[model samples]
Target: MSSSLRNRLAAVVMAVAAGLLGCTPASEPGASSEPAKPHRVLNTTAQPEDTIRVRGDHTERLQAFLRLRYGDKAALDAPWKDAWEDTEVEALRPVTRRVCARDTATADGQEQTLLAVCQTLDDAATVEPGRVDLYVLRVGTDEEKTNRGGFFAQLPADDPLLVMAQRLQGQYGRHGSPGTVQIAQLGPQRRAFQISHEEHRRGHRRVWRSYIAEHNHRLRDVARYRDHLDNLALHGCDGNPADCGEGVFAVDFNTTVGDSNAVEGYWPLTVRASGHDCTGPATAFYHLIFDARQRAYPVPDDLQRDGCADS
Candidate 1:
């Protein structure tokens, strides 16, 4: 082979060897030989946790708790303030603040208190027309601990009950409404949290969704259903409000915790709804019997369907 051809062949062989060994060609003077680091895409999703910081002061500890619970998605600045404090934080106001306690015996037979703190996020601008976020913290007394407390369970913004309610809202083509969170005593040592979303648009429409959840090590959804719906627009009141007449269709639910059977733990929920639609007046009764296999009260198809006829 010719000298020039042999030299080109040798260069090609060296390049192939370098490519096989994952070696890059030398760069110009002062240029970096190190490959550029990949840009890291951070996971901003909030992770619900059952443990939090319990050492700092009330405010500091709350701040730490929010940070730990929300991670990168936590807005620690303006418009988002802690509603747990006694006084209002600037424009933000406390919508719901519930504290429930239960007595239980520890491993050593010492009586311990289980405290549940439930609060809802408040927005100053849209105070009464938006779906508010809820935060729940289950704290236990620990005399030996420095802070004298330890969190046992927590239900953050990503709670299943809240997600289900939001999904219902989406299905109804409704947005921006107010909701409430309350603690319910189901039995002796059993406590459950109930979340209710209510929306009323004067003569146009009205809707309500409710959910009950209990925490046993982790949060479990017990009952969820659309409690009420009153839509006047579906019949003939869409164009003219005054011509609505008596052509309104509405559904109202009356729920009872336990039945006449007097069952013990996790009492059954019975829901009864009565209303009149375009067709005629109707009444529906549903016994939210707990199924041990599914661990959730399955809502009936008729109950889940919209109670209004097509316009």
Candidate 2:
């Protein structure tokens, strides 16, 4: 029931299969190098004067979009200069040709949203017929600080990978799954498949580099979120109105998104607490994000300190 227990459980449940929960790539056959039209404005932050161009290769589209968002100073990760935002895509099977993103950073620093999109072009592919069209990645953040900190992506709620990881993670927590679960039990959560999806993919430098990056992200996210779980417990209903149940904390996931080529965004968890006899729960957002090197822990919401004194 404690936050520490919950975090340990979550860490055990999730191997941090990050991209697994992120949006996927869709391949095109004989498709032109020109970018496709907007499948739908997944989400945007550009002012009315901004020009959103969704044509050309994914690299060009992302660069153009960033320049539009951050002005001419826009520059991408060094390794990804030749591709879509430093994304490593295999060239066979669901061979990805490009990745792109459109984000907003209003001068006022209002809430911002980053939409990282990907496109795959393959000669022969039927795994997901017609799934090759552009669609927002399932995990993302639309927060102002998240955007300014360069950690936002358009990860949707229903991504298959996200669902799988959450299901595995949900088994954790006091009322959820057991705390002793192992990563291997989660079914080879790594991106590389047991079967050889691409013969030449193993040789690509980008592929291996991306995998290393992904592994690092996983380690960082698990440790960070686990720490969040441990710390949130300290603020439980410590000296609250007696009628409320003891330490009754209810929580739900806000989201997980790809922020940039380097660090991923593990958005805050929407949480609230109250006792059994209490009329309502005190709500707040708890974020435990992992920057390229470290995890930023969650702090108190406005009401956390005043109301839940005992917590």
Which candidate number maximizes TM-score?
Answer: 1
lDDT of 1 by residue, 194-299 (tens): 6566554544354455444444344566677776666664554443323356656666778877734423355677788787544566587888766666766677
State in Å the error of residue 6, model 1: 57
Give the per-residue lDDT of model 2 (tens digit) for 123-181.
Answer: 33322211111111122224522353422223232211110110001111221111121
Looking at candidate 2, the ten consecutive residues that score lowest on lDDT are 204-213
Assess each prediction's global lDDT (C-alpha) against the native.
0.45, 0.27
**Once superposed on the true structure, which residue ranges of model 2 sit more than 4 Å away at CA?**
1-222, 226-280, 295-311
> Against the hidden reference, what TM-scores do the models get?
0.48, 0.20
lDDT of 1: 0.45
**How many residue pairs clash per model?**
0, 23
